[model samples]
Target: MKAIVIGGGVIGSSIAYRMSEAGADVTLVEARRIGGGTSSTSYAWVNACEKLTSRAYFELNWAGVKSHRRLAEEFEGSNWLHRPGVVQWQGAGAEAAGFDEGDFDKLERLKEWGYPAEKIDTQTLAELEPDVDLSTFNPEGAIYYPEDGWLDGPVYAGAMVAAARQRFGLKVVYGQVTELLTRNGAAVGVKLANGETIEADTVINSSGRWANEAVGNADHELPLAPTVGLIAYTVSGDTSLRHGLRTPLVNCRPDGAGRILLRANDIDKTLPFDTEAVPSNPAAQELLDRVTQLMPALKGVHVEAVRTAIRPIPADGYSAIGPHPALSNYYVTVTHSGVTMAAFIGEGVTDEIVHGKSVSEFAEFRLSRFF
Candidate 1:
């Protein structure tokens, strides 16, 4: 079947790769450069230890983490994959929204849920990350996940698309999909911004934050809440970190080279909800200061850039995948943790599309839940 995959971010790149591998005539369409959108600015931490709300949701993210390991092995030469694990700690009060200590009793609950979480004291925390100021960062100890890690979304996406093109004859078109071509209430193709049309038997709307607009073009509506998040990149530093740190003030991870990528839920609260603009100078400085406080190694590291991008979060904050209820031959998959779930979701969704099988693990996260 001739399939057109929308968006060229991490999720779309994974889907395109998996679909092409399954012998489908795949075409990936992107409005701009691949992975230049929210994927580029993502924190990209692949973990599920702190998602204590729902067991099902936790399982989904956990599966994504494992899938990433498999991808790292498959693409052993790719420098974007880093599996150094993650360390997270909360403040004295209920400051963090999702990672709040009060929620589900925090570390105790994580251990009970069969998730690998180790409580570390200040000395142990210092041993894990010698450069970080553990006394000021995690005074009351912290939870560390040895299985967690991170990836470079843009680099991974670019690699996937390049492999798909060379191995499976995948066609990549660069232009905005202005409208969905339909016939007798079924999607047949897409009309591009340059007035070009490409016919396809099926179209998958994996357009991240733009998935809602893509749905609108197809004469349907998806209830998506695209929230904004600010990510700041710092200049390369001499001191290195062994794990991604999530303190109450800032969350930071190593950016392959010696640079660090920083963000915080507290800082994001001060910014607008759905803006495409970059963060202000003051906000950028504030993020740098917060990270430097946690990791004294980055005290003088310059803030290279700050980007504010709308995260692809469904209205209910769960995933919305599978075929559209109203539009035939069209499917969509979007969620908040796109980086963590990309490979797993892509592999599962591709099987459903090409082999006529349903991924049992993703049953709860289907688009039917919203409809």
Candidate 2:
């Protein structure tokens, strides 16, 4: 079968790699550089802890975490998958952040669900993250998720595309997909902005925030409530921080090469959709201040890069996958946790397309619900 995948972010890259590995001729088209979209700016935290809205969604995310482990084993190394674990704590009064009663209840539920979690004291927390300053917050309510980690999205996506190219001859095209091509009520392929047409037996739209645009005149619409997020990358500095940190003030993790990634839920709301990097932007400066307060080792390390992108969330705030209700040959797999679910979605979609198997896990995420 010939398959055309729109978007070259982590989800699309994974699908392309899996489809090509399954012996399907696949062509992945990207408007910009691979992994340069939301994936590049994401925190890329791989965990199901925050997905307690529904059991199915939580299970899906859990599968994603496991899939990452399996992928690392398959690749014989985890250079792109950092499993240092994550340590999160909450503060009181004005310093309060996550880990409220609701969050703690969620942690208990996760533990009951067999997910790895432990409520650690201040001493244990210090031993786990020596570089972090724990004097400001009470660590009695802190939680540690031993299985959770972060992903270097760009690196992982690039590696998958490279593996697909070297092992299965996957073709990647760099151009804006102007529209989806349909004939006789079935998706036939895609049309590029340059008027080039590439035909295929199936078309999958994994275009992140651009899913609706990629659908174009197709008889299907993907409603996305995308949100803007900003992340700051710090200059390489001296810090012994190994685990992903979620304190009352900020969320941070190592970005490899001695650098660190910092972001805050509160800061994201203050940012505009078209925010540009102006060296001393208040939002970026606030991130620097928060991280410095947490890890004094980063005192002199300045913000090197500030990236802002829209998070691709379905209208209902859940994943939307499976074939289009009206367009049988057209499929879509877009969600908010693209980093965590990429591997699982890739394998599931490939099974449905190449081997003619129905993925039961995707039954709850079908696009037909919105129609």
Candidate 3:
């Protein structure tokens, strides 16, 4: 089968690689560089912890976590998936009240679901993350999930595309997709901004923030309530932080090298949803300040770069996968947790497209639900 995938972010790259591996002729089209979009700016936390909205969502994310392990085994020696685990604590300013009732309830729920979770006291926390300063916000304990990890999206995406090219002869086109060409109610191909038309038997829309634009004249609409996220990267410095950290003030993790990625939920709300540029200095500096408080070793570190990207969330805030409701040959795979779900969704979607086998787990996340 001939397949054309739009977007070169993590999702699109994964699908393209899997499809090519399945012996399908695949072409990947990217507007800019691979992973230059939302994938690059994402926190890239690979976990099922925050996916507490529903059991199905939770299971999907869990499968995603396992998929990362499989990918690591398959691609042995890749440094993209770092699974040192994550540690989270709860409290107010400069005072740790330990886990709140809500936090405890979530931990209990995770434990009941057979997820690896344990409460570690200050000493254990210190042992796990020796560089972190636990004096001011001395919490009784913190929750640790041994299975959680962080992904370097751009590195992974680039690796996948390179592997696909070397192993399966995947074709990659670098240009903006201007239209999704259709004939007789079936997707036929796509037209690039340079007026080049590449024909295909099937088209998969994995375009993150540009989903609607990729639809072109398909006579279907993808409802996306994308939100802007601001992430600040610190200058490479001396720091031994080994795990993803979630505290009351900031959420951070190692961003390869010696740089750390920092973000805060409260800071995200301060930015406008429609913003396309980097936020002001105050917002970027705030992330550095917050992380410095948590890790005093980063005291003299400066903000290296601040990236703002739109999170592609379906209207209801769940994944939308499967063939388009009205267009049989056009498929879509989009979600807010693209980093975590990319591998699983890529494998499952490939089975559905290449072998005509329906993925049972995708039943609740179909595009037809919204239509």
Candidate 4:
């Protein structure tokens, strides 16, 4: 079963790793090194706290943390990966009330694989992050998911790509897959921008922003629309946020530092990706100000850098994985959360391709349901 996986982002590399593991002859194709897409720019969070009511998304992300742990153990010597428990804060307004009723119970299992999290009280919250000006918020503390961790996105993507090539018998092709080769209304293989075509029985469109394009190349529509998400990090002085924090208040930034990444939760409305301007939304500065009130550290850090990126979020805004509707043999696995969830069930993608199995609840993500 020779497989050609296009795009070398986390989702692409992960799918390739999974295919090779299942004994499928895999070939990973990329225009650049792995993790070059939005995967490289993500503020990697391994938590399911954001989805209070969305059980499906919660479950998928919860599963992703376990997947990363397996990789860490499998490659024990690699420090490129590890679980860094996530601490998210909600301040002022509803977030100040702190945690939805079912939050802890829903997220408790997230720590089972050595990643443990707990809900801290206001006093504990104060101690953990003294720099946060919890004055506006009642400082009700936040939920912590210990089983969660962050990884160098590109490095992890590269590592998985390496394993697929060196450890597993997989071939990786480098070029832009400008077109999908089809015959009798079915996907056969991909034609790169360089005019190279490799025939195959299966093709997985793991391309991130270009997902819809890949499907269109096969003369089909997958109902996916491309949208952009941006992340900009600023270098700073000794600021305070140690645990990663999220707010339900006016703030959209998740505050922490390895260089505090800002404006993670809002869309850069002024700079639509299709336009290509990809501007640093001036609104981000305001969003940063709002988040700093919860974590007072912004009281003193210098603005270091702000980077912008675009990702293809699903129309339903959930990660997608399933066979192409018209062309059954072709498949797609795409999402904005690919950085977190891809590693978790990354193997499941390969399983579906190699053995025709289903792991995630697809009633919501199924490709045909949209058509």
- Structural similarity to truth (TM-score) of each candidate: 0.93, 0.95, 0.94, 0.84
Task: Give a tens-digit lDDT track for model 4, residues 50-152.
Answer: 5444667666776776677777788857765645455565533333222544345434544453335677776776776676665654454567655555667
Candidate 4, poorest ten consecutive residues by summed lDDT? 91-100
| Tens-place lDDT digits, model 2, residues 1-371 | 99999998999999999999999999999999898988998999998887777788888888888988898788866578888889877664223222354246756888888889888888887798888777755645588888789888888889889999999999999999988888989999999999999999999999999998887873577877888898889999889988998876888998988888988888887788888865477888999998999888788899988888899999998999899988879999889988999999899999999999998778789888888
lDDT value, candidate 2, whole model:
0.86
**What are the clashing pairs of model 1?**
none
Flag the better candidate by TM-score, 1 or 4: 1
Worst 10-residue stretch by lDDT in candidate 1?
93-102
In order, the Cα lDDT scores of the candidates are: 0.82, 0.86, 0.86, 0.66
Candidate 3 — what's its lDDT?
A: 0.86
Q: By TM-score, rank the candidates, best first.
A: 2, 3, 1, 4
Candidate 2 vs candidate 4, TM-score winner = 2
Candidate 3 per-residue C-alpha lDDT over 153-192 given as tens digits, one digit per residue, 9 for 90 to 100: 9999999999999999999999999898899989999999
The 10-residue segment with the lowest total lDDT in model 2: 93-102
Model 2: which residue pairs collide?
Answer: none
Off by over 4 Å in 2: 92-99
